[model samples]
Target: MYQVIPPCMELRDHVSHFWFASWTAQQDRVQPVYYQTASCLAELAFAFRSSELVFASVQGHSPHAARYNAGGFLSIFGVSVFAYSLPLLFDVPPAALSGRFCTPEQLLGREGALLVEQVAGEADLPARVRCLNDFLKLRLRKAAEGDHRIIAAARQVMKPEVKFDLSAFAGECCLSPKQFERRFSACTGFSPKLFDRVSRFEYLLNNHRRFTTLTQAALASGYYDQSHFIRDFKQFAGCSPQRFFALSGY
Candidate 1:
C-alpha cells in the first residue's frame, strides 16, 4: 500500500511543497490480483512540490529493495532524513526526481559526513522536521526572494499537451541551449528534456485511476499515443501500469 502524508504547516511562498511519505503492504491484506499499464500506473502516485529528500529505514526485508523501484538508489545507509530543494535549485534536468539518487557530494556540493552522523544518531522526526524547516527557510531567504525565475519557467513548460523543446526554452531563457543546459544540470543534476518527460509521466500516473479508460488517461497526461506512453512507463516504473496498479493497492 502507498500512503502519502503532507506537511502539517503551510510553507512560505518560497517553499515549493513538501510531505512525509510511506508505503507498506501484506500479501493477504488486500486484493491479490490486478493489472494496469505502466502509463496507467503513472496516473496515481505521490507527487511532491519542492524537491524531496527522505530519510528512511526498513524493518523486515531489504528495505531498499522493498520500498523503491529500479531507479531508486541509496545515497547513504541508515535512517537519515534527506534534504530536497526544488529542481529550480538545479534548473530543469533530464529526469524527474522519482527513483533518482545521487552521491552526497553531488547533492550537498561539498564533502562532509555530518549528515551521516545525524542519521545514525537518535532522531526525533518531529523535532528534525522543525529544524529542517528552519534550515530551508534560511536558504530560501538568502536566495533571491519571490518565485525563482527558473522554477517559473519550468512550470510553464510542464504542460502535458506539449513536449519540452529545450532549444526553444533556451532561447526563451536568453541563453544558448548548451549554456542553459549547463546551468540546469548544475542545479538539478539531470537534463531538461528528461525532467519534462518524467514529471509529466508522473502527472499521468497520479491521475491514472481517476479517468474512465486507459486511453483517456494517456491523452490527458500528454502522451503522444498509447504505445509510446506504455513504452516509457515500463522503462521508468519497471512494470506495466496494470500490474503496478494492482500491486500499488496493497
Candidate 2:
C-alpha cells in the first residue's frame, strides 16, 4: 500500500509531500519496480527497520528509470522536496546529484546517519513522518533564504500551456542567460531547456486522461510533433506511451 501526507504548514513552501509505502513479498525472490524520473521534485527515502537512507535526484539529462527490489516485509518513508528547496536542506548542489542515487551519509554525513538511526528506531509511520518533519524544520532554521525570483521562474516553467523563452525569461528574472542557466541548473539539475521539456512531459502524463489521444495531449503540452513526444516519453518514462499507459492501467 502507498499513502501520502501533506507537508506541515511551515514546510509547505519547500516540501511537496511526505509519502509512505509498505509491501510484503509474495514469492521467495525480489520483485522489482521501476520509477520514472520526476522533473520538479527530489526524494529522500528511509528504509524502516534498516540503516538504509538514500537520496534520489530528480531525473535530469539521463533517461533511465530508477529500480528498487522488494522482498520480505518492506516499509519506506520519504519526503518529496520541491526542486528549488534541495539546496536549502542539503549542502550538495542539485547538479551534482543528477542521474544518481547516494547514501544519506554521502549527502548529509554524520547528520544523515543520525537521522537514519532515529527513523529506524520508530515503528509507526506517523511517528516516523513527524521525526522527519522535525529534522527538516531544523535544517530550514540554519539554511539561507530561498530566492523567490528563481522559485517563480521555476513555477513559470512548469505551466504546461506556456511557451518557455529562456533568454527572455532570464532577462525578466534580472539574470543574464548564462547566470540564469547556472542557478536554475543548480536548483533543478537540468538546464532551462531540458527542465522545460521534462516539466511538459510530466504535465502530459498526469493529465493525459482528460485528452482523447496521445497526439492531442502532446500538442497541448507543447510538443510540436508526435515523434518528439514519443522520444521524450521513452526517455523519461522508460517505455512508449501506449505501453506505459496500458501497463499502468491508466
TM-scores for all predictions = 0.57, 0.84
Question: After superposing candidate 2, which stretches have Cα over 4 Å from the reference?
Answer: 28-30, 49-63, 210-216
Expressed as tens digits, the lDDT of each residue in 195-216 for candidate 2 is 8887898789868888988888
Error at 21, model 1, angstroms: 4.6
The Cα local distance difference test for each model comes to 0.45, 0.76
- Model 2 lDDT on a 0 to 1 scale: 0.76
Error of 1 at 45 (Å): 17
Q: Give the candidate number with the greatest TM-score.
A: 2
Task: Tell me the RMSD of model 1 versus the true structure.
Answer: 9.0
